[model samples]
Target: MRDAQITDLPDIREIYNYYVANSTVTFDVDAMTLAAWRSKFYYLGKLGMPFIVAVSPAGQILGYALVSPWKEKRAYRFTVENSIYLGAASTGKGLGRVLLGELITRSKAAGLKEIIAVIADQGADASIKLHRDFGFEEIGRMGKVGYKFDRWLGTVLMQKSLK
Candidate 1:
């Protein structure tokens, strides 16, 4: 695992777009463009947020974990939302835990105070448990807020304090 370089953006985009096209892991119904990912990479770099990726011994990106500003307002500067996505081949290999652990450590080192996870309620038990194991607590749930895969989907909100 390491800090993501500009070259990693394509792999990151592929990893995330897999979920976008195949699952409700993300609400994005369309694949994100490389330019969009580049903009996000630059934005996080400017904020000094954690955006790290796990790679195979062959140097292929396996997964990634990052924290982005939770809100645009100045008062929300200390809080951020966390995102983790692994290539389909990388799941069930404990990479999520390692990436999330590293993400938390890096985020705290970057002086962020909190991390929030907004997870899809459908088919995401492992994710909920992963966050729980890391000391994130379920704070709330919003039901029927997202329509995807021909159904109404909800979100499970979890939060952890770095302090």
Candidate 2:
């Protein structure tokens, strides 16, 4: 695993967009374009956030993890929200644990105090378990907060503190 280069955006988008189109793991109704991903890439760069990707032995990107600003307000600068996506072939092999652990280490090194996880409650049991294993406590849940795949979905809000 290593810091994400700009060239990794397309693969990252592909991984994320797969979930966007085929699963409720993400609430996005439309696929995100490369341009939008570039914008987000730059935004996280400017914030000094950690955006890292896991690569296979053949140099293919297998998964990615990152943290974005939890809120725009200045007082919330020390906190960030986490996002992790793995290619379909990469799941269940402990890649998520490696990616998330590295992300937490980098976030702490970047002086971040908190990491928040906004996870889809449906079809994301593994994610919830992963976060809990990392000491992220479930703070709350929002029911029927999203409509996707022709059904109502909710979100589980989990948080971990670096301090």
lDDT per residue (tens digit) for residues 23-108 in model 1: 99899999999999999999999999999999899999999999999999999999999999999999999999999999999999
How well is each residue in 56-76 modelled by candidate 2, as lDDT tens digits?
Answer: 999999999999999999999
Q: Which residue pairs collide in model 2, if any?
A: none
- Against the true structure, candidate 1 has what lDDT? 0.96
RMSD score of candidate 1 (Å): 0.5
Global lDDT of each candidate:
0.96, 0.97
For model 2, the stretches where C-alpha displacement exceeds 4 angstroms are: none
After superposition on all C-alphas, the RMSD of every candidate to the true structure, in Å, is 0.5, 0.6
